[model samples]
Target chain A: MSEEHAVPAARLRTRGLHLAYGDASIIEDMNLCFPDAQVTAIVGPNGCGKSTLLAGLARLHAPRGGAVLLDGKDIHRLPTREVARRVALLPQDTQAPEGMTVSELIRFGRQPHQGWLRQWSDEDRDIVAHALAVADLQQLAQRSLDSMSGGQRQRAWIAMAIAQQTPLLLLDEPTSALDLGHQLEVFELIRRQAHTGTTVIMVVHDLASACRFADNLVAMHAGRVIAQGPPDRIITPELIRELYGVECTLLADPVTGTPILAGVRRA
Target chain B: MTNAGSTRAGLGVTFCGAGIALAIVCLASLLIGAGNTGADLALATLLGQSSNEEARFVVYELRLPRMLMGLAAGAALGVAGALLQAVTRNPLAEPGLLGVSAGSGLAVAIAIALGSSATTLRISVAQLGALAGCLCVLAAARTRGVGSDPIRLVLAGAAFSGLLFALTSLLLLLDQRTADEIRFWLVGSIAGRSMDQVTAILPSMALAAVLILLVIRSLAALALGERTAVGLGHRPELVRLTVVVAVALLVGATTAVAGPIAFIGLVVPFAARALAGSDIRRALWLCLPLGPLTVIGADILSRVVVQPSELPLGVLTAMLGAPVLVAVVRANRLPSL
Candidate 1:
């Protein structure tokens, strides 16, 4: 409970961020500040630019205009390695190189902290150990990623990001490929990590799960943010209908009191 | 249980094992040639027990330079293959299949046809041609469908290689003396190449080695995927361009001295990955010893396989490497980068 209220007010802001691929602009004039140390879920229909916005925030895609600010400093102005030290991103569909063990994969997270003469150190070892513990993957540290189940592999990837020790983490549909049980496992882990003071932003397809797991929600349609607030405040029937072009019942989950969507139909 | 520390330590052991094997092969290369001098006489000559002038000449002048050439060429091809594979993120990507060495061979043929005999000049021209060829195959691979599908990229490379080989053959037909001087070279051999030829490619090799060191970590990050690599603070485009330049230098240097030795580039890196795992960083290090081991071993076998004359090193390597190439393709799950 003490850690729950201990969220640091580290700020990540975007000012009129614009993202494009060739001539097609995906996200245009985006302006927002991520809730510090809270799990923020960006939910949207297919190709609504949620993922593009995530990539822009993580500095994976250069913005066509404006800028992303980490702690009020323009992210683009910082050296790439310096930015990596502050932000870690887990893109969907990452494939570990053949025969890479979980621990070996996690070691790559330390790259920004290391150089030719500083390949590894006591701090790196400690951080990797802590990451494995946090992900509950200590037993699987030596196991090859190929030998793991989907849930286990997903956890391993998250552990790599955690080992990066960045204050901000961005995941693009991290649980997209998992089974229901595995998805819950990943979501719970993500929640627990966010509770520990790392600001988490994820692109989520499941609006119900977003409501259940995220503290703040950003709903988008057609490359623009349509609503942003607590999930309970923002996830209304009208919002659901507008985002998904579907009619649905909006009710609270009896167990958690978060909004839930049911009886969906094409609008 | 193999943790991060154990894996790093494991790579060190693999490197040492490959080094030992390389040393043994280098000794064998020095000892067992087609010359009348027996292994015992060669060993005696090596130990300075008997100062036979013929034995000294054969061992020091003849066998030694060939051994050095094989070592350098093997390492170059091995590292070049690893770098190319990583840049493409396709385990099957190789310079030989992708027309790099063929391009170098064609450049050398053109140089000879144009009446340029300066050994240093030939190496530079070959390197420039190799850079062009590497860039060409990479561009073809990047075209929409070919980038994701490994086999299609190889097909594109093979088609490009065929075109280059055809052009080289046309050059062979264009002139007789140039053809005579370049024919054996086109087939690829480590035989009778002077130490000067080995020395001539040194700067290029050193340049390649330096570039590889600079980019190894970024290349490893790249195996995770481009966006992931970029997120790790690496400039994927810059890393890829640097790797292409390094591959060009190494392959160009190898082709200039050994004459387009096929499959060494394919086989050496493949074997290194098998031993050292797929981290391009670790695999590149293991390639150092494994490359020389493969080339020197093949060179030794080449001398004995055809007694009076000798098999071309390229032919021997191709004979050994073709099966490996087939096996890599036939593997149920191609190792995804």
Candidate 2:
């Protein structure tokens, strides 16, 4: 078994982690490191604990064993508000209260910094403005989240996560409910954020999208890491069969020169 | 341009209609009474002097305070309900729904049973109970594996309320006087209450005000969901904790003065939404008038329905609130708080 202790962390690191929901154990004895300012994707089959792992790392789920380290310190020990300043998370199934405007949703990203006394500071306003500009949300700031198209709403949510202004962002299938174009809009934004020194870790189901976007890929099967490396190194037929139970040939995508899952027959 | 104008105009009409209802209710609360007093007689007493000390005393001192109590208590309960629903992202998540009211009731019931002055310490003790109830419910909501299901949260609240009610009942049973006091209080109403009761709950109401100002922003953030709340550097746990405490203080104090008036919190917010749309700030604003109108209207109805005997405010509220609860459930989708 390859232990991840040797991997260096720029922002977030998970050490010897375990988790469960009631009687059922979801993940056990897992160790992983998410480097800063890069895109890392965890891709695995449906029941492989991919979302669980993401949630655990974000402190949404407490681990029965081990710790998730943020900024080389234990994330669990940090106040939720304090940790939020450094890391933001986008959940897979996001729900907003009806009639929540895009700007209203993004403005929530400033909650930790705001209080009864310090509610309307200039810094708060400037940051929200900056986030809107970055997400191209200035035009639709007043539009309700419920009123927007799928792609626009997804953008609005991503704008909210970005407004969190954390160096590290963890997204669990942020594109699950989006169409292809909407998916691209969100992925490109995630990529742009990554390029600008924000560390991003996402759980994606599509191997091609994962290969195209992620600089680092972690593949898991039945709650164990089967492979972790660049897409080129981990795209073998056997690895695909182990992770996805799919029998497919891997070819280089001509456009992006990333690994593409092309197929023949079953294993 | 014309279509948008009509939508805005439609909203304007709704708001104006609510305002007119509010004005009429406020004036009518002062006008209508179960006693020998009438609007003309009350007005004569209000103008300066009256031949009968009894009418003057009832009009100026007794009914006025009670009406004010209804207004303030209803207002506070409505806002508390609106805020809790907004933050929990569940429309059913009212202070009373979450057992905060029961918590206050149980504590006060115990106090009264111990031969303590229930009327004197009504506000403080009730607030303390509310705080306990609020904390327990929110802590349970925050615990792992309790994802954002609207029904489950309400269920948890029901269990919490049931536990507190059981405790209250047990305490009330222990002493006859306490049972008398608790029984009178538990039915949830605002009738024949004195100005002293209103004075007792004011400090906590003030404290709740401060907390409300602090909580609204975080609550709006919370409506997005937890991961987002945390990512925004908001301590979701801390915000939840504050919300629990604030809800308890406000609801507890209101319950203390009014004796567990039910459904104002639920129906007021529901009415506020139909009038103001879904923006939390607007919903809260509309709740201020709608809440008092409902309580005072119910209080008036309670008086007139059976001339000499008044209906419990709780009964009246339940009557008003039941249809709302049904509507909430029958909607194509339950609106998130």
RMSD to true structure for each model, in Å: 3.1, 4.5
TM-score of chain A of each: 0.95, 0.95
> Top model by lDDT, which number?
1
Clashing pairs in 2: none
For candidate 1, lDDT tens digit of each residue in B1-337? Answer: 2333237677777778789889999999999988698899999999999889999989999999999999899889999998998899888889999899988888989999999988988899999999999999788767899988888899989999999989988988989999898987888899898999999888999999899899888999988888788778899878988999999999998898789988887888887787778788878888889888898899999999989678888899899999998999999988887
**lDDT per residue (tens digit) for residues B268-310 in model 2:** 9887876666766667767877888888899889888888777
Docking class of 2: acceptable
lDDT of 1: 0.88
* Best model per TM-score: 1
lDDT of 1 at B60: 90
Kindly report which residue stretches of model 1 are placed more than 4 angstroms away from their true locations once superposed: A1-10, B1-6
Cα error, candidate 1, residue B293 (Å): 0.9
